[model samples]
Target: MNNKIKSFLKSFTLFEIFLITIGITLVTTFSIVFGANPLAICSSVIGIIGVVFIAKGSVIGSVLGIIMSIFYIIVSYINGLYGEVVLYVLVIIPMNILSIIQWFKNVSQDKVTIKVQKTAKKDLIILAIATIIAIPIVYIILKFFNTQSLILSTFSIIISTVGTYLNVKRDKLTFIVFILHNLVVISLWIVTIINIQNLSLIPIIVNSSVNLFSNMYGVINWTKMQKKQNQKGSY
Candidate 1:
């Protein structure tokens, strides 16, 4: 356990650690300043930690992701973002579970990072078709639930589903999709805040903003990892 902790800590550079620390501080400060719910603050903190680990291709990220999703579900439920609740319960959690399993199976020589893969053309076609099919179905469901900002909810579902799917595939593209997903989420929550005048939800906005940067970093990190892996040809 001690060794594992050390390895996890050692996986990150000093700059990465500083960034993560800054993210946590900002999330906590935003939540407190905006009078966010305790759950929202917790979710934001966990989410920042989880996503940064994920950016590093660590299985620990998936574990933290599941926990963060649970907190997110409860927060979304209270705010009538039923689309978010359903998406997290049905899609995000399962994909995180699969990520844990797959990451473990594909661990690098360091035994901490997972091997990154480029999405194949066939997979891209399949994902595109799936996104098209899912959009209408998810829209209907969100409509039935009377979700707030229905259009935004539907878009969030599509983006998150595709992002998580790519994440499970260990594709570098996951972060790009997540960057879009975070934008949609930020918009969705901002709408909720305007509708209900609850400043507590601001932490989610802060969380997503932090996520946007983290995912951008994820793209850079994963691209480098993928190139290195390709050169080695060990996979």
Candidate 2:
């Protein structure tokens, strides 16, 4: 257990620590002020941890991602954010499982790092087509249910679908998709917070902010990894 704890701590860079600290502090304060929902708080924290781990290309992050999806689904359902509930339950959960399997298969000989892959042009085309199809379909469904922030929720679905697909493929483009997804998510939660004027939604706001930073970190690190791979190939 001690070794495991140390390993986990060693995975995080100083920048990651700073971002995580800020996210935790934001959530903690909101929880205290809004009368603590333990499940929401735990899910928020775990989700952030998972994002950070994924940024480092660790399989453990995918596992946490699956768990976070479950908790987030429950929270979204309770809040009447049916769009998020659908996304988490029907999409994110299953994708995270597949991601775990995919990452494991790509693990380095040392068994600690997962190799990132380049996105193909064909894959990009498919993602674009899927997003085009998904937006209207998701929008109609959310609209039928009268989901909160309907347009934004539909946008989230589009971003998340592309992001999850890229992520499972271990493409660096996933980070770019995540940056867009984070913005949509931040807007979605802001709408909810305004509608309910509750402190519980504050944690989600903080979670999105943390996600934005984590995605940026992922982009930077993955870029470095790609450059190193290219340099080695040149030799």
Candidate 3:
């Protein structure tokens, strides 16, 4: 365990470590200050940790993603975000599991970090059509369930599904999609806070904000990984 910790620490630069630390600290501090739900606090911290691993193209990220999703499901359910519940349980967790297998099969020479790929133009077109078709269908379902922030919840599922698919496919575009997902989620949580005046939802906002920055960093990091992999003639 200690050796694994050391290796993980060595994989990142000081700046990346600092950025991750700041994110974890911000979520924890905000959760305590706002007296957020205990589940939200757990979810926020685990989410920050999980996403940083993901940004680094590490398979361990997918494992953490599964654990984080459970906490998130409970929190969202309590807040009447049935869309979130369904999205995580039915889509995100399964994608993360698939991601673990995919990443393992597509690792770099080090046999740990994933070898990232660029999404093909044809696939991008397909994703666009799929997203359009999925949105209205998801919207109808969310409305039927009387999910909170109906529009935001529907959009979140669409964006998150695409993002999770890209992640599982090891596409570098995953981070860009997730950045957009984070924005929609931030808006959804903000609306939730306003509607219920629940201070506990503050941690969700903080978690999403941290995720936004992490995904931005993921874009840069994955671009570098893609270039390196191409130069090595791998994947």
Candidate 4:
């Protein structure tokens, strides 16, 4: 039993464990103090963990991402963040699954390290066109549903769409997109918290802070990984 436990624990890095602990502690304390919805707190905790794993370039993160998307969709629905609900349910969940396949198919010889790719100009052009097409459609849906923080919510969908697309392609640009997404999300949640005047929303703020840190770390780490791949002529 001791060996089994140690082996299982070895699967995660020290930083990953630290992030998980912090997420759990924040959620637990906030839920106790603010009478926050336990489900939302739990979902935020899981989502933080998933983001940490994604920063490490692990396909397991994508699996966790799918689970996080489900919980986030539920939380967003209750909060009337219609754009968030649609983004998670319609885009994030499916993209996470696709990311899992892509990452797995691009692993190193050790089968543990996933290779990062670069985005081309054509990719940017395609994404730009897609964003232009998607914005109006998402705006119509959010407007119809009377979504909270309507403009911010619609903007989040746009950011998330670009971020997830880059992630699925293993582009190093994904972390940059995540940084932007995190900013938009922080603003979106802040508006919601102010409007509702609830301390319960504090956990979402904590979650976004952690996500911002994770994305910053991801940018640094993925850059190093890309350099290493380039050194080895791995493309």
- lDDT against the true structure, per candidate, is 0.90, 0.84, 0.89, 0.85
Q: Name the TM-score of candidate 1.
A: 0.96
Q: Is candidate 1 or candidate 2 better by TM-score?
A: 1
Per-candidate RMSD vs. true structure?
1.3, 2.2, 1.3, 2.2
Give the CA lDDT, 0 to 100, for residue 25 in model 2: 88
Using lDDT, rank the candidates from best to worst: 1, 3, 4, 2
Residue pairs in collision within model 3: none
Worst 10 residues of 3 by lDDT: 11-20
Q: Return the clash pairs for model 4, or none.
A: none
Model 3 lDDT per residue over 205-231, tens place: 888898888889899988988888889
Separate clash counts for every candidate = 1, 0, 0, 0
Where in model 3 is the C-alpha error above 4 Å? 1-4
Q: What's the C-alpha lDDT at position 80 in model 4?
A: 86
**For candidate 3, what is the total of clashing residue pairs?**
0
TM-score of every model versus the real structure: 0.96, 0.92, 0.96, 0.91
